[model samples]
Target chain A: MSQTVTKKLMLFFPKCECEKPIIYHLVKDHNLIVNIYRAKVTPEEEGYLVLDVTGTEQDIQRAMDFVRTFNVTINTTGKGVTWDEHRCTHCGQCLPRCPTKALHFADQATRQVVFDEAECIECLACIRVCPFNACASAF
Target chain B: MKTYEQINDRIESGKAVVLTADEIMDYVDKKGVAAAAQEVDVVTTATFGPMCSSGCFLNFGHSKPKIRMSEAWVEDVLVYAGIAAVDVYLGATQLRHGDPANMYYPGEFRYGGGHVIEDLVAGKTLQLFALSYGTDEYPRREIRTYFTIHDLNQAIMVNPRNCYQNYNVAVNDSDRTIYTYLGILEPGRKNATYCSAGQLSPLLNDPYYETIGVGTRVWLAGAQGHVYAEGTQHAGDCERTGNGVPMEGAGTLALTADMKQMRPEFVRGVSLRGYGVSLALGVGVPIPILNEEVLQRTCVRDRDILAPVVDYSVDYPQKTGRVIRYANYEELRSGEIEIEGKKVAVGSLSSYCKALEIANRLADEIRRGEFLVSRPIAPLPRHAKMKPLVIREK
Candidate 1:
């Protein structure tokens, strides 16, 4: 039984090295699913790619290791979404925008909204809905 | 009915039991209005919403040659310095240099005067520039310097208007989403945006403006403040409900508070998408329940406080039959409300969390004897009327 999990990964590519097919090697060699959440790839200097890497525990580890062999730095950040509590006013304005109910009001007495990242599908609904832009990708 | 003096005495003697507006209804329901009126000495009401009519007056002590500052800017945002030589009034809604109105394109209002005030209060060094014509006695012409809020001799937020009694509910009847200070209301009544804390709002609870008046002690941005005057647009002469609460916009409060004691959490700079910037203010007012009528009034619920749902797509200042429907905050806060036929999602610009927090904090302060309730020096006018301006041949 293969257990699959989603994770946020940042892949840094070296300058003037656009020809390197780093993602191809991870999928073909390591058999990992790569979903680019955000990317800044260009024909210029250093570039960064925020990705949702999904596969079995062993294969995902090997995929990250395989990318490192190509001189690509990888940093595993967070699961679904990360909320900056300081920036969040807990306005609860984004509560209705959440389809998955991952973002919810924690206390009826206080009406303060709390985020459960595990339930967040990484659909970026909270990011677009938040008035304060407090919810952001963990990567 | 007990007088305001008797209520203050009860508060001082620790015989006053304080409850938030949200908590008052249940207490009254259990103990009955008559018993609760005698038992509950105060009902603390609060609201945390974007109030655009917010700013501060800063007194920059003095410079070398005592230049009269004709023009002053804090963090690239210009402040009105016409009042005094060294004093400046920085409004929260003032835009930065060359910011497009973006009525059609609708870009984010990234930063403005509100953010500058927040940064200053956060102890961040702000780039300040002032220009003045060189006077014979005061030789200095201009100065570009850096100063924090602490560097200023006085930083007082004397908002001409802060707490609005009631506001219109915003809805978009058009096909596209319209950005406004009322928060974003989606197209075709897809969503509704309301900006009051319902029962917890001070003006909503004290609908008739009985307890809330001039010199009323309030919890302002986490600091002790007072209602100083009638607000700029005090529409006292409006259609009222049977309970004496105005059906539309009504009384407003001019608030004054010291900037030194304010908390950053309570005061936030809000960017209202396409509209502009506004200060997300947290204000809490404690009403001393002097009689059964006061207790009953404080027991008003979210469903009882009604506001007209207005379509924002209507042209400038023209009421093109924009009021589609009337809905209370209870229906608005229920995630969705039935408008025409579609189930419209509802959003509130008011931070109910922060409002509750302020109310609770103030209650705690009162319980600890750190805060005291004060009587209003003057009651609000009962017959004030708002007149519209029109062009005429002078």
Candidate 2:
């Protein structure tokens, strides 16, 4: 039985590394599903891609090792989505906009929209959908 | 049966038994309605949501040269300056000059009169520009100045229509998604959006504006206010149940409060992505326990209130009034409702937590002898029909 795992990651590409088809190699070679929420890979410019890489645990590890050869940096920090708790009114207006239940009510009692960074794929849907501007993009 | 004067006496003496609409249900469930009625003197209800009919009337202290302002713009958003020389009515949903509304297709609608209201209340400096066609008494033709909340003589929030008895559950059944004042509705009934506080709502508790009427003191955005009149388009004679709860948008109130005493957090500026800007304000009405019948009505549970599910993409906009189904607050709060045997998610635009906070605050104020409930000198209309407008050649 293959153990499937999905990792939320930010891949920082150096100026010299943007030319390579790194995402293509991950899909064609490692057979991973890369759902890119945001990408800024430009020629001669340092860029980053906030994405979700899903595949078997073994294949994802192999893909990470392959990307290391290009002098690219991999970070697991959830800094892409900026949410201010003070501004959140807990109206649940951002419920349907979220692909995942990243922003959802903690429980029926309080009915507050709590932020779960682990579940966030950096889709940034809650940023603009929130009428209160409680959610924003850090980038 | 108790009287409004009796309740006020109890409030003044610090002997009143005050509870929130949500809290009253527990009391009634424990002690029964008849017993609870004699013990509980008041029940406070509240709702906080986007009310587009809300706005503020401001009187800017006259300028040095004095200009009879015909046109005024605050933070690039136009304000109705026809009231007087320095007075302006800043509507909540008014867009900025050259807003390019929906031209961007799902426009961000970043700034508007709503944001300006929030900024002013937050004590931020705002630029005001006025134009006049040169008057003799007020000789200035144009003037540009900056002012803050303190600079204005008066900033009063006057909402012409607010606190609908009930609202529809918006759904989009079309192939494409639609953006509306109700928020974003997903295509093919993927999700539903509702905008009411349900059982804790003021009109739902009172049913027929029994205690919430003209001259009735209310908690308006953290300050005291009064119900001045019936709200615009108030269709009080809507479909109802045996419990007297309106099944659709019904009785409403025109409320006013001095914005100087209001907190900025209670009056928030909201920006719907594709739709225009609107203000989300907090309003709480105290329903005095005049009799056992009043106590029983205030004990309305979430299951008792039903909201009609209307498709915003077609039914609502086309005025066909097609209802897919009726779901109570219980089902809506459960986060899912069955549509065509498929479980579709649901959400609400109103903040139940904020409403609860306001209700609790009002209850505390009444308990501490700081707030008192009063009967209306003039009752709201019980049978007012909303009229539709049609273009005609007179």
Candidate 3:
């Protein structure tokens, strides 16, 4: 029997003020798992959050493309990327940027983008091309 | 203005006037006292916690051992009063000479830690004063002298007070004798236990120089602010005395007694500030100002007088650790000798030795002078015309 290895991915969001339930729903609706950590806040800088995830490389890439459909920025470290709301414009231009066809627009009533942390491969291709500067990596 | 040489000559001839407490008061009461007091730049106060009575007992696994404790005595008080500068001096000296191992441990044991003269001298330029007291048929005369360094580059005068009084004076080495001064500030009863000195953790462990997480309460009293801390002792607790007198249920008695001893006249006006240390690093030495220029130019680094001399090491914890120690004779002499490297000859080893000897003799001479009567007041004069001025401009 062959053993399968899963890569760990981490994501960070700087200065997030949204309630925990809303953040959980944004991730759960997309079937993604993430662990949150807080960063030290200095006088000159804003607060930030970090998330760790584990998934296959292909699944991670698929997840990155999927989160982009809702206009949420994403960057991957290991296999996951952060989505910052401050820089997010909710523009759907990045939906066509993902090659895996994982992203799709959600209901207009909900202003959140669906994200699967498990499906991020940390390729950083979508992050580099992100014009909003909302996406960042743990690294 | 007298030159340094003239002052040195007067001190050498035993012609320097020893200012009595009354004379000091009178001098200050005069118009020029502030200017005279300005000559005093450095005032070093060091608190020496009693040595651990259990010598090497903990190292040998003797956990619970009874130790004979000595009377907690105030070691020495160093004051840089005037005449440019003089070395620190003490009236009484007690020297314990024996095998270091038997006292501290086996083998050659050096008194390495708990002397912080360098830290005390960090920003101040002052001479080291060594004073010793003596008693004989000619009269109980305290001798004053100075130090003159020899080729050894360092001379450790063990218990300079005891050496001069008992050993040096007996050998008629008065010329080489260190000067002595009667204590202006006398040792009082050990009345208060602010907290056990042992309770203080080493300085390095404390990040903020504050005690952390220990539910110790501190009482801080400020002139413009209300009392910061107050508490009651447990009932039935007894107050311990320096003379071994113990009184039961003496709540707040310890502080009251200490206040009474420290200032008997104005006990009511004395205020106190106390706080608990989650981590205590002992008391800090106030920075010495060698001159007005030095006072104005010097900057505070790490809330200490001297900058870090060398990096902290476990062996040399005073330098490395947060806690600074008092400087011994050996350390001061070494520092004086090292000054030669800077191309400054304040005095030779013999000269230094003589300075201390002369200081001790001067102290004795001052003590022998006729005591003056009458209390002296501050020199600041109140002028009739020096009323509050109010100006009205059209």
Top-scoring candidate (lDDT): 2
Q: Which stretches of candidate 3 lie over 4 Å from their true place?
A: A1-31, A37-49, A69-71, A74-139, B1-394
Highest DockQ model number: 2
Candidate 2 Cα RMSD (Å):
3.2
> What's the i-RMS for candidate 2 in angstroms?
1.2
TM-score of chain A of 2: 0.79
Q: Would you estimate the TM-scores of all the predictions?
A: 0.92, 0.92, 0.17
Clashing pairs in 2: none
Q: Give the clashing residue pairs of candidate 1, or none.
A: none
Task: Give the TM-score (vs. native) of candidate 3.
Answer: 0.17
**Which of the predicted structures, 2 or 3, would earn the higher DockQ when compared with the native?**
2
Ranking by DockQ: 2, 1, 3
How accurately is candidate 1 docked according to DockQ? Answer: 0.58
The digit string of per-residue lDDT tens for model 1 on B264-363 reads 8877777767788778789999988888988898888887778888888773236564567778877877778887788888777888888888888888
Q: Write the per-residue lDDT of candidate 3 for residues B182-233, one digit (tens) a residue.
A: 0000112101011110101111111111221112111101001111111122
For model 2, what is the C-alpha lDDT against the true structure?
Answer: 0.89
